[model samples]
Target: MTNTRSRGAASRGGWIRQYHHPRGDAPTLVCFPHAGGSASAYFALSAALSEGAEALIVQYPGRQDRLDEPALKDLGELADGVVAALAPWTGRPLTLFGHSMGSVVAYEVARRLERGPGPGPAGLVVSGNMAPSVQRDQGVHLMNDEELMTWMSDLAGTPPAVLADKELLATIAPALRADFTALETYRHPEGSSVECPISGYVGDHDPHVPHDGFLRWAEHTKAEFTVQVFEGGHFYIEDQVQDVARSILRDLSAFVSRRLARHPLA
Candidate 1:
């Protein structure tokens, strides 16, 4: 699932991934990609949920058109920026879906939105990552260029062609390194938690994060918490993308329906 170029005003931005399906008056699904991933990573997800929701993919700095921009190395800072960027679209309810490093970003962003202003995310779907409160020393950012690439390959997120092409690898390494820095350095603030319901998804065989890690996400959310273990490794969504999408839409639709029932337009 890669990005296929589209032309439109919404598609042209350093922050928005243009491959979204704009559902008129539908609730929005905001997606954040994994470490070293671009918005295109969620292109398939966006298309899958197009009819039911407006899927918006976030484009983090140091990738694609944002390549020239300096990548933020702090998770909080990245979340802050995302909150501000999405301020204009707060009229409707939102659901956030993030994978791996993106899970951390989505968690933090949900925390901010819950405490600061506007409607909090209707729900949060965290995939391929442990709970933010679980502290682990991931020193991948500090590794040498060769070591970092090798580690990413082990995670199986990087394409073989991209790894084999020296020029391409060099071009993307800086962003990858910066992304790792953000993930490794993130620390959940003391007593911080989100009020929104949380759903955690993990691969049964994912070596990087186990079911225990995913289960711990329950502690960080004050609302309902559920975990779904799928079959595969770190990038399990590749095999169950539709299942993931359906689960997301089901949860989001239920929440939106309840919200509307309580506060229908006068």
Candidate 2:
């Protein structure tokens, strides 16, 4: 699609970073990054699934190439913006994978996309987040800089080097705070559900969301639902990228095949 003079390529370039685009007929996997995470985090997963799928990773504002732009402070605004940007890419089947804060963002995006006349996602994969119905009043976003760092230190996935470096921490602090505020302030609308199948990936040792919270994901999707428990903490997928990518590709390929079988012309 890049070699041709098409507006789709230009439109997609705004919020998406295409790390690997293979030459073949395959579905696209639109990946959402975690809080304080960038699109580059999925580079390895994109490379691993290069043959099976095209990975378009999201690059939110105030990070990496778009550091000058202000970060999005509202979950609904972020979802709406992403869904609008994705209008050009819904011509083919698409799947979504979101981790941590990305999970909620992905779900919101899916909800918005399904409401429109455009093509809905084939499936949704949510990781490291409890169901939307599970409410908590953790105001980590309102914490002072030192308090926020202390909380981050307690989390299993943060790198010690990044936490220890005052310069780097200052650079990323704004975006991080914005993301936390978004999540902290979010309240899921009652009676909301999506038509696409939903899958949950949970870390066995994650204290944020327990098994019951993960299982509650089944309540939000009318279609099929499944869950996988991996060994580790919040960022467990980082330790099992190959396995996670393989599983996602398998499920998405099966979904595409089913869709084709249902409507031979699709």
Candidate 3:
């Protein structure tokens, strides 16, 4: 993929950084990051799995290597673009892993790919987000700027360095606001579900989504379903990512094993 991308002379060089062994008979596991995050955050996760798998995390624009580009709003615009970028690769069995705002992005990506002309995902790994149909009850757009800032402060998952740095904040705030605006406007209808295997995980003390909301994710898929609750707060998976990675590998093993039994490749 690098040579193909390089030959085309992409402006960002290798926009898709290879974080894991790119070669193997194993499956491909792609990760999407939370809002205001990038691929670098999961650079170490592939090692934590140690599974026979090749993993790559998508680098959203307006951050890190692609910082010069305009940022994606919420999951919809992001997924619309991602599905096109993924057209070349979705021929193989696919698995999506996403955290927090990333979960919504991953879900919508899967949804977009499933609709038009792409292969189905082997499975989906969603963490730290509420159910698909659940939107933020407290509207940040309705709130004043100060109230919104307070909400951001309470989340505390966004890095303090970015929040405090006026220079960087000037660049990041517009993207952040766009992300929230998209999320605030997002709404999944009742019984609207995905067609792939799905797993949902969250922390015990997460304030964003309740346990029942996580459980309802089971209704989204016809394939195997798993819901796990770890011990911590909303951002618990940040430090406990190894545990999340292990959980991903476990389900991915099953998905890949079944695929190999059928296709015997990819």
Candidate 4:
């Protein structure tokens, strides 16, 4: 799959990938991929929102084209790198979306942006993960290769072909472990919350996220909070891309309306 780089996108040190370009005035939607996932995972989503928004998918280190780069084992460091890479794309209203480990990273990035000089995210959408405040000690990152593969298989997030291919699994294992280590070791400060609204999404049968887990995201936002449960497992978006895209567009529209009400002249 060939990807087109928007002007200056290549200057971000390969941290961002743009699959489709939207109108210049359109809102920006920055997507963070799940653990062991690459920016290509969002190609379909970016295509879906091509007309309504500019979608920028993050490309984390140590995966895909960035295989040579070492993956960061700390979530804070990962967030820091993302925040820095996003500095060039903050001119317009932006919304953030992330799944699984990416959800936590997006939250951290939103927090940092809120604390910085520029405007923070117009809103945030967190999917397939629990709230940052809720911490569990399931150390899958420390598991042996076989055990880790078993857990991944149970989650059904990985493709069967990739799982069956030992060489492919071995190639991605280090980056997968690094992502899991960052996710598992992350610790959110009590009472830390973003000022923007938050929308949570979860699959009804996702084992990693409890049935009511998405609701916890409300605690991390100071503004309006909402959640929608979809059918399927952790990778529900794969089957419900249109629905997910609609939900995102709906939330983004609402966020824009709210912002307009607050600052009519801007």
CA-lDDT, candidates in order: 0.82, 0.82, 0.72, 0.84
Which residue runs of candidate 3 sit more than 4 Å off their true CA positions? 1-15, 141-149, 260-266
1-266 per-residue lDDT for model 3 (tens digits): 33454224222333454555644356677788765567877877867754656676777777766777887655577887777766556767788888887888888888776776555677789988877786664666566545655676787676777667777766656556666766777787567778777888888888877777777778777676788888888778777878877888888887767655765654
For 141-249, candidate 2 gives per-residue lDDT tens digits of 8888778877777765678998999898888888888888888888999999988889889888899887787788999999899888888888888898888888888
Candidate 3 lDDT score relative to the true structure: 0.72
Rate residue 138 of model 4 by lDDT: 92
135 in model 2: Cα distance from truth in Å? Answer: 1.4
Give the worst 10-residue stretch by lDDT in candidate 4. 1-10
Q: Per-residue lDDT tens digits of candidate 4, residues 1-266?
A: 11233446633557988877776557778899998889999989889887787788999999989999998899999888888888776654569999998999999999988887666778899999999988855988998887888888888879899989899999888888999999998899889999889999999888778755567888899898888889989999999999999899888888867766786632
* Model 4 TM-score, 2 decimals: 0.94
RMSD, one per candidate, in order: 3.8, 2.1, 3.2, 3.0
Candidate 3: give the clashing pairs: none
Worst 10 residues of 3 by lDDT: 6-15
lDDT head-to-head 3 vs 4, winner: 4
Those runs of model 1 whose alpha carbons end farther than 4 Å from true positions after fitting are 1-9, 261-266
Best by TM-score: 4
* Superposed model 2: Cα runs more than 4 Å off: 1-13, 263-266
